[model samples]
Target: MLLQIKRLSSSYGRVRALNGVELNIEEGELVALVGANGAGKSTLMRAISGVQPTNGGGIWFDGADITKVSASKRVRLGISQVPEGRQVFSEMTVEDNLLLGAFTRPRLEIDEDIEKNYVLFPVLKERREQLAGTLSGGEQQMLAIGRALMARPKLMLLDEPSMGLSPLLVDQTFQTIQKLAESGMTIFLVEQNAYVALSIATRGYVMEGGRTVLEGTGQELLDDERVKKAYLGV
Candidate 1:
């Protein structure tokens, strides 16, 4: 496994957000996590990235235990998260925001990473000098993904990359993700669009409240009676 979470639990003050959640991702696999709002999807992502405190359980990444690792250190260790809400630095130029993602790397490699982003998102190249705040929602999401990619992560945690976008943009975003997966990026995706998520994911898990209630291949979840009724609206 490229990443592993065993009995991971997280809480907000006194409110528990994750209840012994367990999941893993193999190298070159895109694993989707689908659930409703308040299902602890984001919490699980945060815990894996070490931003959220784990009340119990362990997280192992790339053969090392990282349950107690700092968030910045996790990034340096090749774990990158494109957080929900596409929280790009609104005041920074697109290029500047992107450069920040490679802050820990050698300065010589920064330009190369930026060029790779340009190849992935041509619009970013055109708007490289523009303030990040001016981009559309979909554009910002793309920028967020680009920023994370600048880290050249081995495992990427994507929290709701399709959260707020037009239908067409959502499709476009998903296509980009699919391409990323095809290229062997290990992606752990947290999404509310169960139908679309399960369609592209190699494997998937369904969450309810704070627990993982189901796990299977994408096609299996899409056809599952409970998942179809509660999530896919089948």
Candidate 2:
């Protein structure tokens, strides 16, 4: 497995956010986690990225234990996160933001990686000199994904990629995600949009009350009666 979460639990001050959450992602698989608001989906993503403190259980990546690893070290270990809000550097130019994602790399290697991202997101190249804040929401979302890609992560943790997008933009965003997966990037996606998440997922898990309540192939979850009623609105 590329990633593993064993009975993981996390909290925000007094309230628990994740409780005994078990998940695994194999290499090159596109895995999706679907849940409702406050289902602790983002918290789990945070825990996996080593940004959130886990009160219990373990996080293992590529056969090593990294439950106590710092977030930056985790990034060096090939994990990167694109947070829910496209939290790009508003005042910085688009190229600057992409440049920052390669902070750990050698200076000579950064430019080449940036060029790779521009190919993935040609619009970002067009806006290379423009301030990131000036882009439209869809463009900003693309920028967010591109920024994370700049890290050259083996596993990308995406939190709500479809959030706040129009129906058209959502389709486009998921298409981009699908393409990334098709290119063999291991992706762990957390989304409130169950249908969209499952549609492109190779396998999926359902989170509720901070626990994983279901697991199956993406189509199986989509066909599941319980999933249909609670998440898919079937």
Candidate 3:
């Protein structure tokens, strides 16, 4: 396994958010976690990224235990997260914001990575000098993903990448995710859109009230009657 979460649990004071949640992802695969509001999907992602402290359990990445590592250290260890909100710096130029992603790397490599990101996101290239705040909602999301990619991660944790976008943009974003997976990126996706997520994912898990209630191949979950009634609305 490229990543492993063993009996993971987390809490916010008295509120228990995760209860012995277990999950695993292999290298070069796209795994989707789908759930409704307050399902603890985001909490799971934060725990793996080393931001939300785990009350118990272990997080192992690339054969090393990182259960107590800092968030910055996790990023350096090839784990990158594009947070729920596309938190790009509004005042900085698009290129500058991307440069921040590579702050852990040497100065010479940062410039090279910025050029690589532009190639990956052509729209960003055209507006490299423009402030990130001025971009459209979809464009900003792209920039956010690009910023994470700047770190050259082995595993990318995505939280609701399709949130607040038009249907067209949503399709585009999912397509980009598919392309990334095809190019050998390991992605652990947390999304509310069960239909779209399952379509692109190789395997998936369903979370409800801080617990994983279902796990199967993407097609199996899509075809499950319970999943259809609750999530797919079929």
Alpha-carbon lDDT, every model: 0.93, 0.93, 0.93
Give the TM-score of each candidate: 0.98, 0.98, 0.98
- lDDT for 175 in candidate 3 is 91
The C-alpha RMSD in Å for every predicted model, in order, reads: 0.7, 0.8, 0.9
Candidate 2 or 1, higher lDDT: 2
By summed lDDT, the worst window of 10 consecutive residues in model 1 runs over 46-55
**Candidate 3 regions off by >4 Å?**
none
Position 9, candidate 2: lDDT:
94
lDDT of 1: 0.93
Q: After superposition, how far is residue 85 of candidate 3 from its true place, in Å?
A: 1.3
Q: After superposition, how far is residue 23 of candidate 3 from its true place, in Å?
A: 0.2
Tell me which residue pairs clash in candidate 2.
Answer: none
Candidate 1 residues 104-123, lDDT tens each? 78899999999999999999
C-alpha lDDT of residue 158 in model 2: 93
Error of 1 at 118 (Å): 0.5
Candidate 1 similarity to native, TM-score: 0.98
The lDDT, on a scale of 0 to 1, for candidate 2 is: 0.93
Error of 1 at 156 (Å): 0.9
Per-residue CA lDDT of candidate 2, range 95-191, in tens?
A: 9999888886679989898988888889999999999999999999999998888888999999998888999999999999999999999999999
